[model samples]
Target: MTDRYVQATMDVLGAARDVFSGHDTWRPLEEAIDAQLPDDYKALIDAYGPVQVNGHLYLEHPANPFYPLRTWISETIEDFRDVDWGEEDSPQFGGKAGLIPIASTDRGEYAFLAPGNDGGQSRIFSCGRDEPDLYEHRMTFAEWLYRYLAGEEMFSPGHRDFYPGPVRLESLPTAAGDRSSKWYGQERST
Candidate 1:
């Protein structure tokens, strides 16, 4: 059901809050985490196994002028069984990229939409990671677009990465990048 994805994302948030709400200085269990099912998210669990939510791949602690804290939920490609997540011979990401992610942290909610110009291509946006007022203003972008496409299971940053696609190097722009100043990453090369 459409609501299922929301529930799964919520479950993860609950766990995060439990661990983070208490202190001003708190980090996740690890940079690279293999999502452990919270029982409630059992249905959300992928057939392959639990999803790869927050990871070092998304969050780079490097000391750069651009922001770094890029936390997000990464899902395997097969999660989208029928969807053409990524095509073969994609130059950038190379091969099939199955792990799609809904990126979020203290930065904001953004989705690595899908691979376009080869595996290295993607469309990122603030999903629900906007400020209180902003979140209210946006977030329905992906929802509306996916609906127009008539996609059965739309990809939410926090939902299961069911789409089988590629994770190209060029697409890894930090939230601070021109893509939108929604989060902190790197400045887009004009």
Candidate 2:
């Protein structure tokens, strides 16, 4: 079953990549499948039966919603505590987080996301019968990489979640020869 699903996933993704790129606002379920499904994704298929992402059924979107196989979230950004957390319905929090289903022509629909506890960082869980309420669990940076996408530093600053500043160099190498030194002319000419 897993092998068949993975094979079907690949076929759908190939076509989704083409159509999804153009429709930025309304995307095909194939996009996520193409992006995340692994070559041997069958090995990772969920053993606990089917699951949902956000409130949508695993494959409920207009396009087919592929079972995530497994979903993960990581904390790549910093300063989330700095953001002014607010109502979930607010523009900042509402649309910012949810189950984002990716399209797949063959296997079906797929999703990727970082759902917030109160429009903020907390645990990530797959949507199911009880949805986030039942499936939710703590997700930390050490465990997942996808959490990085949740915070948009440049676009939404008030949202506390910010990317780390560019790394800086701390030290320099010694001059090989006095003649080659940047200070060479300063002392000699003086």
The lDDT values for all models are: 0.27, 0.24
How well does each candidate superpose onto the true structure, as a TM-score?
0.20, 0.20
User: How well does model 1 score by local distance difference test?
Assistant: 0.27
lDDT string for model 2 (1-190, tens) is 3334333333322212121122221123224322222223212122111222122222211211231221211110111222343646422111244432221112221223334344444343222221122123344221221222223221122321322332111111112331211110011110
| Candidate 2 runs further than 4 Å off | 1-17, 26-123, 130-132, 138-190
Cα lDDT tens digits, model 1, 1-190, are: 3444334343322222121122221124113432221222222221111112222113222111243222223232222234342557331211223223333333333333232333432333333334221111122223422331232222343433322222111123333543421212112221
Worst 10 residues of 2 by lDDT: 181-190
Residue 80 miss distance in model 2 (angstroms): 26
lDDT of 2 at 125: 28
How many clashing pairs in candidate 2? 18
